[model samples]
Target: MDDTSRIGAAPRRAGDDVIQVHARLRSMILDCTLEPGSKVTQAELSRLTDAGRTPLREALRMLQQEGLVKAELNKRITIAAFDLDKLDCTYAYRISIEAAAIRVTASLLSTAEFDELDRTLVDMGEAIERRDRDEFEGPHRRFHQMLVSHVQEGARARMAIDADWAERVRRFVMQGDQHSLARADAEHREILEACRARDGVRASRLLASHLARSAFYVAAQLEPTYDTILTRTALRMVLGDELAQTAK
Candidate 1:
């Protein structure tokens, strides 16, 4: 078995064991160490996380609900594959929602809140200079989350789901080229400036464009391998069939 399978074979107790296992497995998938379309078994996951079968099963089920895993015939579960069209759709939604959230957040910001955002931006700058992807992603996520969570509690929660989608795209880009990381860092600066200016409208527009640009760049890199039809169809199914129907 491979490292992923090996990691999948560990064990755990209950309560936090279940959450810890889920986070570990999810991190593996997001980092592309697990790869899209990889097969997952509860038995293997139990070994990887050192958790019991019951918790492993529960973790997998939760991942499935989050669109990170898919159940196949015969009870097998596979990591969800990358689909450009679905990614594009997700980018579109993220741009719109997050921009709006930022705008709202900016409108309501206090001195302390602005200072916190500024500090996060500085941390991002340091992370970039150090070329630390791991360090960068944390504060990067927090900065955006703070902006959105200030606007609406639910906004951050919804964006958390979208973050998983973004991670899939990021993993692909990082695997292919390191240059993309610099571009992302630069974009974050622009976002920070807009927020600091307290120009909600401008911030919103910039945020939208920033998100779109990343998707466009990643999609360009994936073009050689991605099937347009397959991506579009998959995204339509995910958005319409799953998310849409579930709300009904």
Candidate 2:
């Protein structure tokens, strides 16, 4: 099926329609189809998503809360512009929260949770082998989510949103040599091993370093001189000064 047709296909229920529309719109923004910093009216979005005003408005409102779009004065909405500073801070927030959460969560993972994580790793490996980022994304998110499953509800919700935002920044800012898929998989394995050993400190340090390096790599691509100081600071806070310095 064509992209527009697929995105615009109506759902059976009104609530489903809103969710479908939201996912479609979010995908478009993240895929850069609705290019960053571009401005469009409600009418344009309605036609683009082939969604009615009610569902489209609801979807836009959701995206607005996620900081993916900005509602303007004349019913226009601007796609959130890509910013290096924002990207840095996003990773910083993620590093701090996930590292802290994993410290408590790692020792608590059950056999079923470990099995689920193992399956996700296998799925991620298959996706990587196929060079299918869309496929890889699901398992990747699941891997992270499962690690922090025991975290408090509010922080867990924030992590979910941050995951989407992190994916958006990676799509928008990272390219070419900035990517290290192989190393990423390796890091995932190491982190998993640490969790398996019930070594929360090791897992937390590994996760912080993994997240920090990703942010620093992306920042380097955008501006070689750009320092993701916030990310570094977060890593240090999680891993401490000596370990953080050697985390790279």
What number of clashing residue pairs does each candidate have, in the order they appear?
Answer: 13, 0
**What's the true lDDT of residue 140 in model 2?**
88
Per-model RMSD to reference? 10.2, 6.0
lDDT by residue for model 1 (90-153), tens: 8767866787788888777778877888788788778878877677778887877777767556
TM-score of each: 0.72, 0.79
Q: What is the lDDT of candidate 1?
A: 0.71
| Least accurate 10 contiguous residues by lDDT in model 1 | 229-238
TM value for model 1: 0.72
What is the alpha-carbon lDDT for the whole of candidate 2?
A: 0.85
Model 1 misplaced stretches (Cα beyond 4 Å):
1-16, 73-75, 129-132, 149-157, 224-248
Compose the digit string of candidate 2's lDDT tens values, residues 201-232.
Answer: 99999999888876887677668898888998
Clashing pairs in 2: none
